[model samples]
Target: MRRPLLPPTLALVFALWPSTGCHLLLDGEPAAGIGAPCEQDSQCQAAQCIDEVCASPCSTSAECPAPATCTMAGLCQLPLRAAFVHVGDPATEQWTQAHEIGRQAAHEALPYLQTEIATNKLLASDAASAIDDFVARGFPVIIATSPTLRDVAALKSAEHPGVKFLTCGARSSATSNNIAYSGRMYQAAYLAGFAAARRSATDRLGMVASLPTPSVVRYINAFTTGARRASPAALVEVRWIGFWHDTLPPDAQGKTRERVLTEALLASGCDVIAHQADNGIPVATVAAASLTAKAIGNNVEDACRDDATSCLGATYFRWGPLYTQLLDGIHRSRWPAATLVELGMTLNPAHSTVNFTLNAGSGSSELAIEISNLLQELAAEGGETVPFLGPLCSTGQRDLDADGTPDCLDPGQAPDPQELQRMCWFVEGLVEKQDPADPTSEDRPALVPTTGDCAR
Candidate 1:
């Protein structure tokens, strides 16, 4: 049946309107093929639009058209689909940004492995929904980039037995199909601590920290232990900001919680400041807070790169190798065994997952040489000279094991992996201030600085 013609203005409006619910163009030139440009799956005959191009789902190269090999993501054109679950703003959060950088690198290195990121998944339910969506879309790999999402990933992994899951910085016990991995970041923190202590004239240091989690506690303990080796008189004062990233409302002075907390630490007479939080705000605040004070950074190298003179050094993570290894495993059909791996220099000597960078402009050449020697010693076989070695006592001197002995590690005795994984106590010489109003008040942990020789 012939339809009636519309008015000129109405005809132009209909012509300009975007076509939807159909894969054919107005001219009816067949259907958009795999190489055709598309904005959505509905616009393509293949029903898959990836990276702005029509793609056909394929499990192997034989299933794809000639000259187009199948990617690990089961797509003819795009690579394997890997998704990273983020809790904070990657642009503003250093930790999440670091993982994002790694994601980009992994995509670059393994063209067969494509990547996607889902942000603002602050709650377990939010992350679970995102993960489920990714799984429904045939994403084979999921990397939960926060400890908070560790349990969420675990439960999802159990539900999706074929999918591989990796949880970063989680101390949880490994499950049958989930891989728990974290870098040995405390080693780098120890190095940064030594540099900070060497640059401090008053032997008083400050650290802006988040919650007292096991990983955070390990970093603080290693840093304090390193500082004490450099200066026995070193005393570390800690301020808890109660979050992994800065998100608090501005104060009356228009300063953020990070800045306000740093100022309070500076007011307490700390000469050098360090931070375990996931941003450079604390470091930048130190630059503006005082002319003589210094800062040590964490989780990223930009701290020293941004202000070499003001920042002594920083402990950073390089996740590229780890991600590459995992993705390549999928490519080779050699998925990693489900277990917990604490990757360190001992395991990754070629390119460490964790590293420390120093600013030569801020410290003397002697200090650099000392740090280099210390790093070599630490990297040597068995970690005998590691900073966590004892004759160490808690600042509060509470009995940890309840065996009627003070919670002190005797000389030549080192903390086992299980004990370190659950450490919530501080070593001696730390001036821990507890604010009942803080979110981390339930965990009243402290830091410690050693006196005299720890070997004694």
Candidate 2:
């Protein structure tokens, strides 16, 4: 027996309907057309429907319009023109601010280069995904700002040998066409320490830190050593904040800790405070400003907005020129594949952008002069000053290897990479080390100079 003829409306709807495509429903019947509500198979003109949305079936680039490719994510996307990307944490607004300056300079220097910035609290997986996405889009260069993302970059570089990756503030053991590593902040930090020492009043100093990582530890030691060189009677006390990414509560807590530490040091006669802590400046500055008796400022020269203040100058990092240099390298194809690039306060060779700043007040002009001289000496010597190498010893009779030979100062002596990597002892004359287990200690780590070099 023949089936009864379907209604004209139903028949028309079914004819245009797709078996598994997106469609629109009209007048209680299935519909098939663009911009129509759709469901499974019998509802749309296209066989593929997604959440009532209809589109042409696409399995590859040929199935899509020109310049569009079916992404693995199952969507058509425009082809990416840039070949490089940079990832940074937006939370590190201060640090990233400097980096963005460099990015801008880079763009200016290399008008033809393209770059994309990704900001987030990057995880290893997130880094992997970012690299994968970039690679899939034909990007050949990736720059990561945080140390934590280094490993992922290394892994991705290994997986894709043709890609090039650069990491700032991260050191890696792996070497490949895809990786370049550098962390030259130590040079700047050493100079800043000298500036801090030249500005102290009581000769007792304070340093606030964000973590005990090698980079931070190195800066702390260098600062303390520099202070000692300027004022033998100077004592540097350090507090570790235990975190790199500054947070509000802990940051405030670090400030509180700085206040308490400064008070204790002041009670014991400390008059100046400096810090290696990222974003610890606000807290340290506030504490310094709050003090009725002492001077305050950290990395940058402390130039208080108020005239009647004792805020010394501060040391500021400028990243814009450096970024521009890298971009230039990429554009000119002069970028070294596996070399570590170190950028400093010196003018950028390609763009002449200065990447360092100091904010010493007029009262600290003498200190600034001394610091400038020291920097010049260091630069003249090709960055060869080692503050801790000296006829040095701790206050506690920690004699230098029993022969009275200074650990760091003997010619040709340098700390072992491993020891330098895990420094924990406080230098002689410093007040305290932030105890990892002690809640009472500041959230930052303290560093002190030691009396031994490479057993030379």
Candidate 3:
């Protein structure tokens, strides 16, 4: 993580220095005032087109507008410095890796954009210094890729009104200068579950899950719901590893907990395994243990790239376009405050936010065919092939309506966005675990959904 290198006074001086670039004007008329569209210096009133914008010449930071710094080129420019903070090593963790890809893509799309990253910011406290350091270094935009940093992002946004901040996976309402954004990944999860079930001969699907976070639970529920849709007899057994990264200590057998749990699931007749964990350990474990068993990847495309033969595609998020759009809005200063931007297949015209990928070697099995078909259906514009429709029930069989039944939803009904974000219950097809320590345990127990697990 980055540390504060310059004192407050010196930092402020550097922040206002030539580390930023100008933003474009809205008008297209030639020789328009600063902030108007321009091609060359002749088209701008200020006689400069710096950073693809009509820019006012400035000798010092004092002559520039607030948050716009005087560049070395003697032009007033908005701070184009942006930083991305990740929870783990992006090289090893698929979730963080996705954001890194986004950051690169954004930079490539906007060459004037300056970007940096701080890794291993797993907590708010860990991320706070990194964010402050970036701010002090003249980064006017901070993109935290983990939900754990949302509170700190909120605090910092209020402290630095000139700086824009964004946090991932946060359902909270955005405030001035800070917005919480997330992708609707459950849609892809449903398709992955359906594929897993279709590929399974025993109709037994296993999931190595991390924390029972609302988002994770929603993914699990959607996965199970999809599996049941494909094969009514399908039962998804979950093994909670308790940590998003699953860096738990290895057992006496010299195996990581994720590997042990994955092997156990395979041993218990689970022909296909899926994971909601941060890393691709489940896919790796399955690839090494069973020749026939397949695993589903999460968060990144080609997650099973290392073990494609043992993999059954993946549900991944492509953050490039979304990041590009958000950064572009910030660059143009058109972003609205206190707004929540939830991108998904239906919302984004490209349908690229939440996506699925199938291995080319998956062959012509029923699973592969169905996955291809579902992908086509989902890719269609304004399609209604959603996964979380009605006729569903919770794991505990709790009554959602007063009709004296355990059904959570009636036929043809769909869960709202808020409900999906705050989902805390699993679907009816989730097999209850007998013992928390035993990943393969099948003994039934009374399970209930509560709000505690929904807290981020």
Using lDDT, give the best candidate's number.
Answer: 3
**C-alpha lDDT of all candidate models, in order:** 0.72, 0.50, 0.72
lDDT of 2 by residue, 7-101 (tens): 12111111121232121223432223433334554544433444333334456756644444454534333332333333444344445554566
Pick by lDDT: 1 or 2, better one:
1
Model 2 lDDT, residue 387, Cα: 50
Q: What is the model-wide C-alpha lDDT for candidate 1?
A: 0.72
Residues 1-456, model 1: lDDT tens digits: 112211121111111112211122223322235544456777667446665456677778887664455766576653456889998777878888888877886776665676889998879999999999999998878999988788899899989977878888665544555778787788887888888899998888988877768788778888888899899889888877777765668878798888888887787678899898888988898888789999988776676666677888888887776777666545433444546666664333335667787866888899989988888867675333457877888876446667767677889777887777766667775775576244333323464322211110
Q: List model 3 lDDT by residue over 18-106, tens digit each.
A: 22224434455332355443456676664476544666777887886555567665666655778999989988889999889878877
TM-scores, all candidates, are: 0.77, 0.64, 0.81
State the local distance difference test value for candidate 2. Answer: 0.50
Q: Could you tell me which residue pairs clash in candidate 1?
A: 73-80
Q: Lowest summed lDDT over 10 consecutive residues: which window, candidate 3? A: 8-17
Clashes of each: 1, 40, 4
- Global fold similarity of model 1 (TM-score): 0.77
On the 0 to 100 scale, the lDDT of residue 182 in model 3 is 77
